[model samples]
Target: MPDYDLNRLGSRAFEQMVVALGRPELGPGVQVFGDGPDGGREATYDGTINWSAAAVGVPGGSEVWVGHTVLQSKFQIKPKPQPQDNAVWLQGEISKEIGHWIKAAKAGRPRGTEA
Candidate 1:
């Protein structure tokens, strides 16, 4: 695909993949968070992590980052977060932080303001 399309698809793909990883049908113990400032995504599996493939940069080297991790962000070094990075993390502390922005969003109308 073209570089523009690939860049636009990065954050979306990461969010979807993370949600897929957290699917109860697929299995449990998986959690994810997206909507980052740079349009990044974070995911964890089981409890093991490698932190390598966090930012699967654009295919053509246009300097577009793909993913972000709890410990580091691909934007720091612009290193290629290839498909091989085993992204995983722990909860407890991060859960609170994630919860800060994890609330369900609605396009319009407040929960109690309806008339």
Candidate 2:
């Protein structure tokens, strides 16, 4: 696995992930579904393209989700992460670094890494 300075990882990578998401052609049918009242956004597509998420910059947010686009998905939360996203590759490896941007109640910078 590639090495990324999680300490410096912020919302930059996540932002790029969202933008790359616009290019569904990057992978197969994509979907961004969320539970609860924050009905956010979802995307999907069906194309034969390879892709990979290079651990760079910040995935943004406090949550980091990892998995394939059409086969599987997963995420882990630490102290918390800024709602962020990952990069899109053209290879066969399918993974994600999604960050859930939920407003905190304390209104201050959060800390730690997430799953």
lDDT of 1 by residue, 59-87 (tens): 54333323322321221122236533322
Worst 10 residues of 2 by lDDT: 90-99
Compute each candidate's TM-score over C-alphas: 0.24, 0.21
Best by lDDT: 1
Cα TM-score of candidate 2: 0.21
Model 2: lDDT to the true structure: 0.35
In angstroms, the error of model 2 at 22 is 7.4
lDDT of 2 at 60: 50
The Cα local distance difference test for each model comes to 0.39, 0.35
The candidate 1 region of ten consecutive residues with least summed lDDT is 68-77
